[model samples]
Target: MDKFDKKILSSLHENARISYAELARRVNLSAPAIADRIEKLERTGVITGYHAQIDPTKAGLPILCMIELTVKHLDYYVVLERIRNMPQVLECASITGTSGLMMKVAVDTMPSLQTLIAQLMQFGDTKTSIIIDMPVPPRMPQLLADD
Candidate 1:
């Protein structure tokens, strides 16, 4: 990607709903040119999908927790599949550490968290931590001009 593409991605990361015209103005490109570049970015998988950031508290899922799981056996994919199907599991990643997988979970109540933990325990041992606050929330990568 060139500088213009980098600028376009940076602008879109800030606001995905930005109009093509506005984006073109920011990147100093014609509206149609900007649209074509964006289309190419999406087709090449550089731009994945857009999402709306929601307040978990207002959405009735205030509790957020991180769970580190250690499987009993090496068949981690089996455990991953089970976790993937859970509605409460917001994100899960396989990491290189003591734990096989780490999951970010959101729930409505303490009882709900307990139930979810119980279900996860069926697959392996787990260490969970409640998220008190987010000093730095998740953000899209800052695509550099050099890249």
Candidate 2:
């Protein structure tokens, strides 16, 4: 991507709802050019789907926690598939550490969390931590190395 493309991505990352004309003004390109660039970025998979950031507490999921799971030797895929299908699991990832998998989940009540943990225990041992706050919430990374 060139300088214009980087600028477009930076602007879009901040506000996906920004209009093509506004993007053009910011990047000093024509509206059509900006649209074409964005389209290309999407087509190339550099730009995925847009989304809105929601408040989990206000969404009726007041409890937020992270679960670090160490799956059984043969149950990694099984555990992963089950967690992927769970609505309460906001994010799940395989990491290089003591835990084979890590997940961020939100639930309605403590009992719900307990139930979820019980289910996961069928596959492997788990370490869970309740999230009190996020000082640095999720945000986009720089488009370029120097950025």
Candidate 3:
């Protein structure tokens, strides 16, 4: 993509709902030009989607835990897929360490977490840690700034 495209994406990433006029000013483009660029980005899947960030606690899920899973073998894609379908498993990823899968779970209480743990145990050995506090979530300027 071009410099204008990068600038547009960066601005949108910081604030998805930014007005077209404001985005144009930030990227040094006209409003219509900005619109065309954004449309093109969306069509090409460079800008796949926009989302809102919310607190799990306020959304009826008060407890959070990190579940570290160890599998019997490296071919654990099937297990990962199963975990992904679980409602409690809000996020899942394959990490480059001891755990085959690292997952974030949101539940109503500690008992709910225990139930999730029991379900997860069917796949492999499970190690879990409850979230005590999040002073800062590693939300880096997730927007790709223009070079």
TM-score of each: 0.94, 0.94, 0.82
Model 3 scores a C-alpha lDDT of 0.85
Q: Write the per-residue lDDT of candidate 2 for residues 20-58, one digit (tens) a residue.
A: 989899999999999899999999999989999899999
Model 1, total clashes: 0
Compared with the true structure, model 3 gives a TM-score of 0.82
Candidate 1 Cα outliers beyond 4 Å, as residue runs: none
Q: Which candidate is the best by lDDT?
A: 2
Q: Count of backbone clashes for each model? A: 0, 0, 0
lDDT of 3 by residue, 40-83 (tens): 99999998898887789899998888999987675497787788
Q: What are the RMSDs of all candidates, in order?
A: 1.4, 1.5, 2.6
Worst 10 residues of 2 by lDDT: 138-147
For 55-123, candidate 1 gives per-residue lDDT tens digits of: 887899999999998886766778888888999999999888888889999999999999999998888
Off by over 4 Å in 2: 145-147
